[model samples]
Target: MAVTRIAAAAAHFGRDLDHDLGRIGKLISDARAEGAALLVLPDAAIGGYLADLRHPDPEALPPALKPDDPIFEHIGALAGDMVVCVGFCEAEGNDRYNAAVCLTGAGVLGRHRKVHLPAAEGIVYRAGDSFAAFDTPVGRIGMLIDYDKTFPESARTLALDGAQVVACLSAWPASITNAAPKMSQDRQSRLFDLYDCARAAENQIVVVSSNQTGAAGGMRFLGQAKVVGPAGNVLARTWAKAGLAVAELDVAGEIAAARRVLRHLDELRPESYRVSR
Candidate 1:
């Protein structure tokens, strides 16, 4: 099926969940106008990446800092013909999770909890250990939240599950600047770019990344959202802005090219690649 990937980098979440939902609604409306089939929003697009909004001290947050506060219903309502995937803070009893929720034409089809939490993430959020992919109307989709994108194993799991596109929702720091003095910043960007591109090229699938933008709390978010084609070519990209990137992926072409080029799927080296506990 033909699809368009929409990436939106916008303002931080507010206490008014309805307002945030409305803003996202507008984004989806815009994407739909452009004929987009999938909307991939940044991490914590609903309530702001809670870790960034939270104080270093866990005690600083309120008792009901998180729970089903109507955002879910609003987001659920937004799902219809298009598939929407967003990162948000998930509240489960006394604990919270850095999670990504997938809303397809059917409804909330799947959720993948973040397995690889960054250094300070463990301070306020609980890490999740599951790696899974869900079937979507267009194709099978996989999700990875922020830090989990750094590892290839996560993408491999999704590819193994027959996912044609792996979507990443992230809230990364802007320390990776493009300034002359901050050459390392460019390096950081390239690192992630190469990682995502390699995942698509090697697996013969597509990779769509949507990251946050602007400053929230004391942290500056880096927005470098893009889509990599099966051939590792950048199909669409946004240069640190609140915008959308649409790209059409060729699932059949990817499968055919993968078999013609690498043919690794037929090269059974699983015994050698397997790790011992």
Candidate 2:
């Protein structure tokens, strides 16, 4: 089976919920109309993740921002035959979480909260505990949000759980001002290359990443998104533009990539590497 996937950055940040969600909805519709079976939108597609800090109290967040928010029904209705993976803020119980939602034509498949958060975001959102993968019609997909991608152990755990595709939804910012020059572009690009190659080669799984674009507050987004095969090679990539790129994943391509590297997942000796936790 060939899995058709599309990815794009939610480059622009709107002033309010209604404006941002409307743009997100239109982006989804456009991707679906372009014949993408799965669409990956940038992190916090609905509401600006950290751009606006005056977040509603956990209990006061509108239903749409809540995990069980009925707006999922509207998203489900619009899903058509495509599956969607989007980043958002979710409310579960009394705690607010930075989360990514996975929705398919069959309804919501799962929600993965961000386990690792930056110091700046830690004040507003609680960190998550579990790391798991979800099964979709396409295959088993794993999710990691933003900063999580930098940690090898994070994606390694997902690979151990049988994730065929490991993806990240991030609001990546450009370099800060310096007396010499800015290096944020180089930094983010290098990070992307490291995570993409490490996760793909170490686990023999496809890696996809979507990053935010445009400027929010004082930060400027880099806006480069890409799909990489198991061999750590670029299959399809989107430039700085806020557009979508589609790629087809075939069993042959995936298998060849893995076999070409000849993975050693079965030869690990976890017994000797045990840690006291």
**Residue 262 in candidate 1, Cα distance off native in Å:** 1.5
For all predicted structures, in order, the TM-scores are 0.86, 0.86
lDDT of 2: 0.72
The digit string of per-residue lDDT tens for model 1 on 1-277 reads: 4434444343355335566687788878887887777888887787665434434556543223343455655676776778888777787888878887888545677788899987667877788987888888768899988878788888888888888888988877654224324423555556666776887877777888888777755666667778888778878887666677777656656556666857545664787887779
Single out the weakest 10-residue window by summed lDDT for candidate 2: 176-185
Please write out the lDDT profile of model 2 over residues 89-181, one tens digit for every residue: 787666778888889656888778999877556767889898899887767888888888888888888888888777778777765432114
lDDT of 1: 0.71
Error at 20, model 1, angstroms: 1.9
CA lDDT scores, all candidates in order: 0.71, 0.72
